[model samples]
Structures are given as structure tokens and as C-alpha cells.
Target chain A: MSWVNWILVICMYPFVLIMYFCLKNEGHDPKKRVYYGVSLSKEQAEDQIVTEIGNAYKKQMKRLLWISFLTSVPVLILPSFSIAFTYWCFWFLFVCFVFFWPFGIANKKLREVKLEKGWTTGEAQPRYTEIKEAAGIRKVKWYHFLGPVVISIACVVWAVLQPRDGREAMLIILAATFGGMTLMFAALAFWMDKEKTAIVSSDSNVNVNYARARKNMWKNFWVAFAWFNTLYTVGILFYQVQESEVTGMFWLLLGLYILFTVILLVWVIQKSKALEERYADKMDLKVEEGDDAHWLWGMLYCNPKDKHTMVNKRVGLGTTINLATPVGKGVAVFLILTLLSMPVLGIWLILDDFTPIQLKVEENCLVAKHVTEKYRVPFEDVREAQLLTKLPNIGRNYGTSMDNVKKGNYRLRDESISCEVLLNPENGLFIRLETEDEIYLFSGFDDTETRQVYEAMIK
Target chain B: MVIILQDGSEVPVFKQIRNQIVMGISDGRLQPGEKLPTVRALAEEIGINSMTVNKAYQLLKQEGYIMTDRRNGVRVRESFRMTPELPLESKEQLKQLVSEARVRGVSQEEFMALVEEYFSAGQRE
Candidate 1:
């Protein structure tokens, strides 16, 4: 297999690993029955029933694994789509079939087992009072915000120092976005830090330690994210300087980010588990299930009671919006619109390869048209129009190019003349038109059309 | 001070917040001139509507229980004086309480003691 194919295979590893872990750890899930009100001891027959349930779960999981493996073969072997589409398919299958289906099944089975064995009890005792009010904002040191402040300053400085270029401008925008996000995350961290139990527990020491550890983890995660963003911004700038396409480096960086995220998630889960284990003896295992029911898919919080647009996830992993609120709904709509626009963008990009560029010399003007853009040059404003046998080294101001076809506004590096460019690099007339205000660059994609358009324009 | 909103309560959320703050100040749980959280901060912390919290703050400020400054968002009024005029609703509530005490077959001395207990309860803290 080629190196590209190897990268593709490697990219599939995370999904495989996630599926393996999900299936492998199914048996180890805590069997703590949330029996409401009445506390019941394990009966002699309960063990047998539990064992039966466990065995059934394991069997079902194994069967699912085999089925999933068989089903994925076709999808895996299917001709290459976009990498994003492939990864999305893997994720969708894992979530919908492998994870969600089995999880729902097990949950249903567990409920059924509890009901059959007469283990279910009365209504849950209210424990909202004991759930503890989150303490007010804690005093945050100035240094906690230093990383975001520094990144913000650096982004501003970089943007100000860099010469005006579209690619450079995009880089600066990305950096600014990253810096803004970092600052928001930093602010969120400080806000979340204030969440403490109102009731002083007998295990205050352990609680303090746990809180500290979690806070430190959050701080480190944000700092790491900031550094990663900085490096990525720098990478893009470097790629632009090298005059190289960003696709390969972009994918590599994205892959690294995904890998890092999975590792971070695993680390957080482990740490949280350790904290829970240490405090299990001291703290009550059950409490008021505050707003847990409103959460859909264990991620999206849809609480109308929450006034804030953004909130920390219950798992202390990341932020989630209260989607019931107007602001959250707006964000959700914007995100959906962005996602929906991707296909149109992809189609446009693909069409650029096939779309024929046409330059029509009419009675009063010359009209240049491509799939992505069109430009009209008035005869009155056109100062000079020339057809060159060979094109100069020109950079794209804003347009599309694939292999031999280049059509857009371009800047001539040697002459420093802005022009309309419509050129097929292989075999086309390089038409450089200098209008009164600006230069119009055009290059035709077809060799015949190029010669015809050149001859027509010159005549 | 932490404000807990009862999900099942018949009272509206804004009223609950207002009542709680009033109770806090009367009982000295919230001291005179104590700085209260910003409306937004409190709203976020309690996971309640900011408008509800703002309404509560507005009520408190109007009643001379709290004061607001440009730099310091809101605070318990240092003057800490109750309005001279009591609302008719409060008067009616007091009348109802007295009538209830009389109907319950309690002596005037016992009723007075009960009233004294409640009034001093706020001063204990």
C-alpha cells in the first residue's frame, strides 16, 4: 500500500480502539443499582440473575462485534470518498450501532431485571438540599490568565507586523479566533473553579485535593490547547512562506489533534475514576440528579432553567451549551448552516476542475467567466491587452486553480502589475489586460479557445 | 449568600430570590454593607434567569435593603433602614397572624412570647 493509504489506515485506528475499549469494558461497568428509598440486600438468587444478565450482555456484545466487523467490510473497501466522510462513517457506525444500541439494550435489560427480581423501590428521596450549592466566584490570581493574554498580544503583533496578504490575513484571523477562545476558556475555568460543596464534608481534605487536581487538569488542557493553536498558526504561516499547499500539513495537524484529544479524554476519565474511588467511602454515592434528564445523548444540555449560554459539561471534560436558550439555538443554527454549506463548497471546488473558462469579446466589453467567478472589462477602461506565449510567475489574489487551469485576479511578481488572469498553464494564451483602475488577468483552459480569444482580443 | 430555588415551590422564582435576600439581611446572615454578587454572576451560579435576579435586585434596591454603585455592582445598604410605610398586604398578614394566635386558644403572653422569639431570631446571627 501507498503512504497515503497507510495514513488512511492509521486514521481508522482511533475508531477501532474506541470500539474495542467500549466492548471490552462492558462487563466492568458498576452494577450499583439505584434502588429508590428502600435499601435492599443482595438475595441468594440475585447473584444467579446478575450472572445471567452479565453473560447475556457479553454474548450480545460479541455478536454485535462480529456483525459490525462483517458489515464494515463493504464500507471499508468502498472507493475513496473524502477523508472526512470516511472518518464520519466510522464514527457514526460506532456511535449509532456499536455504542448507543448496545448501551440502550443493556440499560433496558438491567431495568427489566431489576423489576423482575422485585429490586425496584418507591420514589426517590429528595437530596437536593445535600447536593450543595456551588460557592460564589473564588479569587483568581492574575497569572491564571497570562497564557491567553500573551497569546492575544502575540496574535495582534503578528497581524500588525505581517504585510497585507489574503493568506496572511486568514492566518491572523485564525490566531485571533484561537486567542479569543483561549481567553473564554480561561474565564470559564475561573468561573468553574468557584463550584464547591456548601456543606463541609468530613472528607474536606480529599475534596480539596480532588478539586485541585481537576482544576490543574483543566488549566493544563487550556494551556496545551493554546500552544497547539499557536503551533498550527505558525505552521500555516510557514507553509504559505514555502509556497506549498496546506492540505497535507493541515491533515497531519488535524490527525495529531484528534490523537491528542483521545489521549486527554482517557487521562481525564482515569483521573476522575481515581478521584471517585478515593472519595467513595466518604461521600454519598447517590444525590439529587440535577438536570441530568435534560441532557440528550449525554452531551447536549437542554435546560431552560439555565440562563447562561455556555456551561461546563457535567463530566468536567468540556463546555456544552444550554440549547434551549435563544443564544444556544442561534449557535446551533449557525453551526448547522456551516455544515450544510460544506457540500456546496466541495461541489464548487470539484467543479473548478471541470468548468471551462470562457472569455467572450463582445461589442463594448470582454467578459471572462468561470464556475467560481466572473469579471467584465469595459472597452473604454481597457488601456492595454496583450497575449503572451508564456506566462510569468503569478500568485492568486483570489480564485481557483487545478494543475494547468488558472483563472482569477493575479499579481505579477516581477512587474508588480495587478491583472485579470485566465491561463491554462500547459497550453493557453496568457492574456494580461490593464484597465484604467486595475489590471485584469485571464488565462484560458483550452488551447484552441486560448488562441481564438487571444486573436479576437488583439483584433 | 447562596440562594436555592425550589423547583416545586408555588412561589415564583423572582419572589423567592427577593424573600431570601430579605430574610438574609433581617437575620444578619447577610451583613450590613456586604457586597452581593453581580446579577449576571448570581444568575449563572444559580442557573436561573438573569432577569429574575435583576427583578429581585430592583425590588431590594427600591425597599432600601440594597444599594448599587457604579464600581461596586450591588451591596446591602449601609444605612440599613426599613421604610416607614408598610404595605397593606404586610399589615393584613400581621392581622391574620394575630387572629390565628387568638383562635388557637393561646394567651396574650404566650402570643407575645412567640412574636418575640421570631423577632429575636433575626438578631441572633
Candidate 2:
């Protein structure tokens, strides 16, 4: 497990590097960043303002790249799972220092440059017609949603038919993720339709260029997300955990997912950057208008009057919540709560593996209790009871189990019956009972205690 | 082909849509029998209500600027010809315009030249 953590860290460093580059490269587009769509006048262009700005940006990027590389080296020394708390704190602080602080500084520098060069425009004069036409085209067609819809439906059918108890939780989570993404994509498409493009270009060609670029970026994003979700669902559906490779394949799949997501994000960022560079000249022109006050801390949008809860980032390919609005605040709170709950859930899962399971005899019935699930059997329903020293080598056909804690339905090898099993594998003291309808199997983690219970049951 | 709606304008939204389409037609930007976007599509494109676009389409249909059918949807009329006789409303409007020009002390020649300039501007667009 520690090695797994270390491997993850090592693998993620490149992703962090790419993210750093993207942030450092922010505001490289003077059209969108400085003039806010109003291109610089010919005089402004020849003033060497653009050149000075470029030099300043390049210097900052170079310095930040070095710092990023140096800071990331600490991961090599941090062992997986050891000092987990400290490691996580360091990770959090490192991210903020590298990304957040640098972003703010760079944004401020760009603003200063804009002021110095008199590049900031008075009003945004975007070609509204071209923008409207582009927005109309950017909508997600009916067919774009087909993949996720079909996948979710198939997941439901698979869950009902297969009924793998242990994997049921995993399957349901996958289904919800895909289904939720479908809804999100639809919502985002509509939101984008109403987005006020802030570029102030009179050049219809430049407006079209920007619009088409945005459209392509969104299209690629949705397509990639849909494909990734479908592939993950398919993987989970057909995945069989072999006895020889306990948890190995599962971990492998998780690692692959992380790498795939990182690659997708990098590709999107690089593509967006390329498009900006390619269209920068065409979009650069006389300054007209912009909304410099809409952003807070160079990242968060703080528009009190804006009705939008989520908006596209000025410099990137993601949506940021406008923290100024009530709805946005609610969304922010929800996100924070979700983030905080993850570690708590992890702790709960870890504790579940250690909790003792209690099985006791009652006046007229038997009771079994684990941490969460409980079971009971009336004496009247018991047809036969037997204690065995050895049990068959059974696999968890469908249900959850740790090293010793096992519960739920299972298939016994070389047997036709699908028995209801609730047992800890450590006990090796098997309690088999035959009811009128079927057989039930139970085991205990402690062999001595389990044997005594079995004897008492027989008596 | 661009419809710019002024929020504080005296004209309503539907009228704006109707006027733009009519202007587009007269300027030859919209060819004879050219297909227009469906009412729903136009409404969504402009971020306006469907009823507004519907009103505009209905007006265009009534004025003979556009025609609609079950299969073809909305389109510019196949042939456009100026009416030989001006409607009473249009005549009244012309009279008011002439009276305003007279009051402004503009010569008939100057007024005719201004009209020619305005009409040619539309053609150029």
C-alpha cells in the first residue's frame, strides 16, 4: 500500500508540471488578457509593449518552472502511507504555493502591464452576431448524450442481473458518475449558449476564430469525458478479481484512470494554448471594452450582479463558481463539504476492517452483528446445525470482505448451492445450518470462540 | 442579417426581428425563397422567447416578406414586387414625413437625395 502511494506520487509529478506550465502561460494572449478583445492600436503595437510583456511573462515562467521542479523533488523522499497526515499537508501547501500564488502574481503583472501600456479598453465591442451564431453552433446535439444514456441504462441492467454484492457499490458509483456527467454536459452546453463573450474585436474573422476554437474545445471535452466514462463502466462490469491477484488489478485500473485523466487534461490545455497562439494576431486590435472587476484574486469570479453560478475561466478550460452570488456560495459550500468528507470516509472504511463481529444465542433465536449489517435466525427455521473444522475454498461471488471480515452472498466451489455467508475467514470454524429453504454459513475470526459458539449451538 | 435589439428602444422585440428580416430581404442579402431559421431555432439563437420569434414570423408572413409551409418551414417569398398602389397607412406616413421635411425647411431635391442615399446604403449592405 505504501509503495502504491509512492508510485502514485511519482506518476503525478508530470501532471503537476503540466499544470504549472499552463498556469505560468496564463494571460499570454494580450487580446483576451490586456485589451479584452479590443486589439492594440498600431501605435500601441509598435511601442514595444507586446514585446516587453512577452519578455516579462517568459522570465516569470522560467523562474516558476525551476521552483516547481525543485519543490516536486520532496515527493521522492516521502514514503507512501507513512506520516500520511504530514505528507497530505505538504501536498496541499505545495499546490497552493506553486499554482495559486504564482497565478495571482502573474495576473497582477499582466494587469500592471496593461495599465502601463494603456491597453485596457473602455467597453467590449464584440461582434454580437458572430458570437450568437457561434453560440448556437456550440450546443450539444441530441446524439452527443446518447453514449452516456445508453451506458447508464446498461449499468442498471447489469447490476440487477449480475448482483455481485461486493462490487455492487462500485458499480452503482460508476453509474451515478456517468449519469451525472451526462446531465452536467447538457447543462454546460446551455450555459455556454448564454455566455457573454468578452472579447471586443470588430474583426468578424477573429470573432469567428475565437468562437470556433471555443466550440472545438468544448466538443473535445465532452467526447473525451463520455468515452472515458463508458470505458470505465465496461471495465468494471467485466472485471473479475482473480485469487492470485488480490487487489492488484483493481489498483492497476485506478492508476490507469488517474494517468488517463491527467493526459486528457494536458491535451485540452495544450490544444487551447495552441489555438490562442494561432489566432492571437488576428484577434489583436484597437482596445474597446472589458470587465476587469469581474475577477477576484485573478481566479475566482466575484460578480454580484451576475446570475450565472458557473462560468468559463478567462484563461483556462474549466468553470469557476462566482463566489459573490448566493447560489455560487451554496455550490462552494457543497464542494468544501464533499472534499472534507473524503478523508472521513477513508477513516471509517479503515475502522470497519478492525471492528469485532458478535454472534450470540438467544432464547428462541440466533443473532449475528457486524459493524453495519445485522442478521437473525429463529430456532424454528433451523432444520439442522453442524460445526465443521474445515470449510470449502469459496470465493466472494458478490459481497464485501477484508482480510478476515467477510459477509454477503458467495458461491462455494464444486457446489451448486449459492449460500448466504456471513463469516470471518480467520476462524476456520465453520457453522453450517440447513433451513427449510436453503443453507446458511457463518464463521468467526477467533477459532476458539467460534468453536465454543458452534458447540453451544449444537447443544 | 444581424439583428441588434436595443433594450431601451421604442420598438418591441418582435418588431425588431420583423424589421431586420424585411431589411435583409430588401438589401438582397436574403435571396428569393431563401430559407430562414425555424422560429424555435431563431429564438434560442437570440436568447429570446419562442413567442417573440413566433410573432415576428407571423408578421413577416402577413406582410408577404416571408412565406411558411408545413414542409419547407419559413422562407423569403419567391418573387418580390413593389405594390402599385400605396396603402392608406403608408400614404399617411409619407404625408407626415413630407410635412416634417417641409417644416425643417429642407428642399424637395435635398429630401429626394437623402432618400436615394438611404436606399442605396441598404443595397450596399
Candidate 3:
């Protein structure tokens, strides 16, 4: 690499660090406290504390950004010297170190906030809500993944196609790909933040924003950093092994680097485990007192008459409809398809040929001929129905299914039906009517109840 | 009776619910026979945890201020009554208020005369 290229890379380090801290510290803000029809003034002790923490976080972020910009100035000038490469690399590493410094400080401040005020204190309460708000609309708004996916593909193709002098190019391409992947991973983290239930436990004493952002940033950084380092190390190894002219000193340096990286990774993993254990120990699981009737309160589409409706505790679906388990079935389908294609594709690649897997609907069933001998009932046969009792492992143990049914666990009255059928140990057909349209075929039912239910449903 | 829960108020939500219910009962705005909203309804209305509303109701029941029947749901206790006796300090404060009024150029005769006039007018209406 030219001196200018090295300088440019060094110059970008502080900016990257600043960006990291900015993203990490983004969620720390005091939420406006509300009590009995009145807005509590920030003058209140708890509110004041929250304000101070938020202000401190903001100030720290500002300072970190300023320092990053200042550090970047030296790299822009492109220092002309014999040790320019070393100087540029060291400066780049320093910038990366500084980028995470604010996050470390913020983490400490969060610990302080947790200690000084009780974990469930007002200042700590609002952090999660604030972070959720800051995360913006839930879906992955940033098209970060596309760039990484493209770059990764390009790097792989280039490495395969190019015969000689491609090692250095591959290393640079792989590094850029890693960077792009980091951005994509960060976007995914934000997306997960949106989808996951914002359950800020009442007993959590620390500011949620401080805790959540810290946890998320640390998680994202280390995961990305580790993966990047691993890939870079592999790339370097590949280059050294492939090239005939690599020096003995380079091999020595690579060995030491690998050893140091492994040690650091181990330490991080141990620290993370300890932190998780500590949190688990401190967390209290309290059963909040309330009638089950109150559970439906403030819920969307909840009517007084809908009190008896049996809702899925897992999927949050009401008894009246079968909502697609969000992202579950789709992901399952993708995985199944991928698994089936892998062997075929691998073999085809060796033969330098390909054949597309065909899906066919036979007798109202989706049959996969080229893959597993599995078939799915057509959509028309699928009924949206609720079980009379909570399916085993579905409902709260404290509540009896019979009592709920007696109290009126209204099930969906859909026309379409699907049954899950299975064979028993005695070779009897054990058919489970899953929906109105489809029957799942399986084996090992304890009794004849499964056959009886299936017979009743089909009849 | 409408009860407003201030989300930003320093008081906890349950306490707010309890205090409002108490105030409503004492002021006779909530009648003895009247049914209060279910815990779920109340919580939904106030945008608070239903458990908090349940807590308030539980407290009210323990205080003999409300009754809950599974069939009829929650209602004000039929025999619920606030103690009529004024505290000694309050009685003393009343005496002080009368004395202050007397000092401020109002006599007992004038106060009685005004009271009689109001009563006579009410009777005529």
C-alpha cells in the first residue's frame, strides 16, 4: 500500500471509533416521569439524577467525537518517514482504541447509576423505553447487508478466478467485506431490538437505555470484531501459504498475533460469562398480583365480550384466528430447502452442472420429490382453530385447561382443516388433526384418543 | 365518576387509583350501590398495569369500602360509611375559624341570621 493509502486508513480510524461510541451511547436518555395525572418536574431527586446521567452521556459522546476528529487530522497530513507504515498502523489502532473508550466509560457510569440508585430507580426505568424510541421504525431501514453480501461474493469469485498476484487483492477485498458485514450485523442488531418484546422488568434497578445500549454495542462489537479478526488471520495465513516469497519474520509475527488474539478472545468470553451470571443472580422473578381478567386490559382489540377468548400465550394470537407464527415457518421452509439443495448443489458443482428442485402439489398436498419424502396439506385444508385445552407446555401451569374451557375458551370456527397423522407402536394410525385442511402423519400416541379424534374430525 | 391518572405524578399508579376511589366515595360521587369498572377495564382506561388496579381494589375491599361478587363483579359496599366524627384538632381549627370571623367584624347573631335566611330561601324553593 502507498503512504497516502495507509494515511487514509489511519485517518478513518478515529471516525470509526467515534461512530461506534455514538451508536453505543445513543440510547441513554432520561424519560419524562408520569404519575397520577401529573407530570413530575425534573426538579425531583430521581428525575435530576436521570438528567445528570443523560447529560453526562451526551457530553462524553461529544468529547469522544471531537477527539476522534482531532486525531484524524494527523493522518490527513500523511507523515513522510521510514516508519510511516508502523506509525499509520499504530495511529489507526489507537483511534480504534479511543472509539471504544467512551463506551467503556459509559458502561462504568451505568454501573454507578445502578449502584447509587436502586436498580428499579426512576432514572434506570426509562432507559429501555428511550432506547426503543431512538431505534426508530422496527424493520432494517439501512441497506447495509446488501453491500457486504455483494463484496463477499466478489472477493470469493476473484480469488477463485485470478491465478497469480491475487493474494494481496483478496486480503484487501476480504477486509472491506468484513467491514461491510459489521455494518450489516449492526443493522440486524437494531432490527432485532425492534422485534423483541420491550419487557423492562419493574425490578430492574438500572437505567434501561444505559444497560441495553451497553449490552447491545458490546455484543455487536465483539462478535463482529472476532469474526473480522478470524477472517483476516485466515486471509493472512492463506497469503503466506500461497506465496513462495513470504519472509520467515512474517510467519513469526503471524504466529505471535494468532496467540495474542486467542488469549484476548478467551478473556472476553470469560468476562461476558461472569457478567451474565451476575445479572442472572441479581434478577428477581416476582409474580405480580392481578386477576387474569386484568391481563386483557390495554390490549388491542380487547372487548369485554372477548374476555373468554383463548389467546396463544406464545404467539399472542387470539382464539378466533391462526396468525402465521411470525418469521418461524418461513425460516423453517428456507432452512429445509437449503439443506435439501446442499447435497445436490455440492455434487453438481463437482460435475460442473445443476438441476433445479421441483415442488409439486399432489392430491392437495405440497410434495417435494427431489428432497425429503415430506408433504404439506394445501392452504385450503388448513383451519385456524384453537385447542380446547392449552396444548401441553402452552398455558400457565397455575391455570387448569378444563376450568378455562368451562369458563368459555372460544375456539375458531373455521371451515378449512388440517390434520397431523402419525403411526403408533402397535401400527395403528395416530392422526393429529392440526388444522381444518391438513392431517400430520406421525407415530407413538399413548392411547387410541388420537385415532378417535382423527376419525371424528375426518367424519 | 371520571378519575384522571397523572402519568408524570410522583405518586405510584396504585396509590393514585386508591386515592381517587377514596375521594369519589367520600364526596358521594360514587354511590353505595354503584359498580366500579373491573380491574382490567380500569387499568386499560388509565393505561396502567391491571395488577396495580387490582391492588387498589384489594386495599379498598380490606378497608370495607367496596364489595366484590363473582357474579356481579365489584361494587361499592352497601354499609360503607365514613366516620362522621371530626378530629379534635379539626374541631379546634373550626373554633379558631369562628373566632377569626368574629374578629373580622362578623358576630354570632349575624352568622345565625345569614344561616336562617339561606334555610328559609331553600324551604321556599
Residue-wise lDDT of candidate 1 within A1-459, one digit each (tens)? 223334444555565556555444533323222221112234522567565755676676777666655554543444433433444444444533464455445545555665677655433222121111233334455586775568666875786577654445555666676566667656666655654432213333444455556556666665666556656555645554444344345457667766776676566656656755665566533323343345554346687755556665443234567799897898889876766565555455556655777777777778778765778887788788787777777765446554546766555767654456665677645677777677766766565676677687677
Most lDDT-accurate candidate: 2
Instruction: Point out where model 1 deviates above 4 Å.
Output: A1-133, A136-142, A160-172, A187-209, A241-270, A277-283, A287-292, A297-299, A306-321, A325-341, A379-391, A396-429, B1-6, B9-125
Superposition TM-score, candidate 3 onto the true structure: 0.25
In candidate 2 chain A, where is summed lDDT lowest over 10 consecutive residues? A125-134
Better of 1 and 3 by TM-score: 1
The candidate that wins on DockQ is 1
lDDT digits (tens) for residues B15-118 of candidate 3: 77777777666666566767777886655434346798899999889878899999998898877565867658659977987888888998899878985785
Name the docking class for model 2: incorrect
Question: Of 1 and 3, which scores higher on lDDT?
Answer: 1
**Candidates ranked, most accurate by DockQ first:** 1, 2, 3
Evaluated against the true structure, the overall lDDT of model 3 is 0.43
Task: Please write out the lDDT profile of model 3 over residues A1-459, one tens digit for every residue.
Answer: 344434345435434643554344232312312111112233432555545755665676677667666655544454332233334445545554554454445444544544465543343121111111222323333453444445455555555564443233444555455545555555444434433222223332332432454345344444545355445545643553342333344434444444554454445445544543445444332111111112221121222321222221211111111122333344446655755554454343322211222333456543322222244455356553222222221111111112111111112213222222212223333332355433343322223454444333443
Native contacts conserved, per model:
0.13, 0.04, 0.00
lDDT of each residue in B62-101, candidate 2, tens digit only? 8778899999978889875658677797699889999999
